[model samples]
Target: MQKSILWVFIALLAVSCNQTTKKEGLTTEADKTEKIVTATINELLASPADYQDKEVAISGMVSHVCRHGGQKCFLVAEDGETQIRIVPGGEIDEFKVEMEGSTIAFKGIFRVLNAEQTEEHVEDHESKEHHDVEQSHSTAEKAEYFVEAIEFKDITP
Candidate 1:
């Protein structure tokens, strides 16, 4: 009986020490140590190649907000002509967010989609009505996406 109790305690200790490793998935540590960069949305969109696979610390006005299934909040930040997506998750804060021009600055992993493969250029003015401007949306995109919670940094022009 004494040996069995000792073995159970050893098993518990081993289980506590042996933490699982994730090759690809969401993790608490992943949310903690993400990289951060600071740049305007226009700069990011203008030369999407510059900040690719880099975390961004961005500040802009909140343009739009949409909650899909109440799990995550997706919003858009607009600076003149450029816009960036703001995706926030978890119990962030109990603050009201009025979009359509509210200043905000946040840090997250920034991803710029490939424009050449998915987007097309339009040069004709008349054809502009019927032409579909290219949109930067693609899979395998590494961008300014942050997991877990994000703090409300500050407002900017």
Candidate 2:
């Protein structure tokens, strides 16, 4: 009986060691990947150039997702005023309309638009918005920040 008990203890110890080794391997791989800087919608908007072309992780509530194709979505900060446009990668394919209003954290590269690009984006966006809504948007309002999302998953509880 004592021998059996000793063997069981040894088995448990071996199993624990194996699990720890696996976890350590996963951590190493993750550490090797590029680090994601966390920022809010307001921070990104405050200085779009600072975060532009840099990989980052941002958290915000999904205010709107374009119905035209689901390629675009807008994330609104807690203030409910500031927003950043997100263009999901091919991996994402599309975003569901139901995702609107849900908070999510996503990894992506913040993109900056020059005056020319901004003007084009605004024009495209206006074509999709309601006539009344489009009339209210100023040139400044149309040229907000943008993000190219590589990965996204619901973070809301």
Report RMSD for candidate 1: 10.3
lDDT scores in order: 0.49, 0.77
lDDT of 2 by residue, 1-157 (tens): 9999999999999999999999778757765887787988778878878888888888888877777778777787768666777888735788889889898888888888888887788788677663355321133246556778877889877
Query: Listing every candidate in turn, what is its Cα RMSD in Å to the true structure after a full C-alpha superposition?
Result: 10.3, 10.4
Output the TM-score of candidate 2.
0.70
Task: For residues 1-157, write the lDDT of model 1, one tens digit per residue.
Answer: 9999999999988776664333224456666777677777667666766777677766766544432322223334353544555555333542344543567666655554454533432222224452244333211112333222255554655
Question: 43, model 2: CA deviation in Å?
Answer: 1.1
Error of 1 at 32 (Å): 9.3
Candidate 1, run of 10 with poorest lDDT? 137-146
Pairs of residues at least 3 apart in sequence or in different chains that clash in candidate 1: 37-57, 109-143, 109-144, 109-145, 110-143, 110-144, 111-143, 111-144
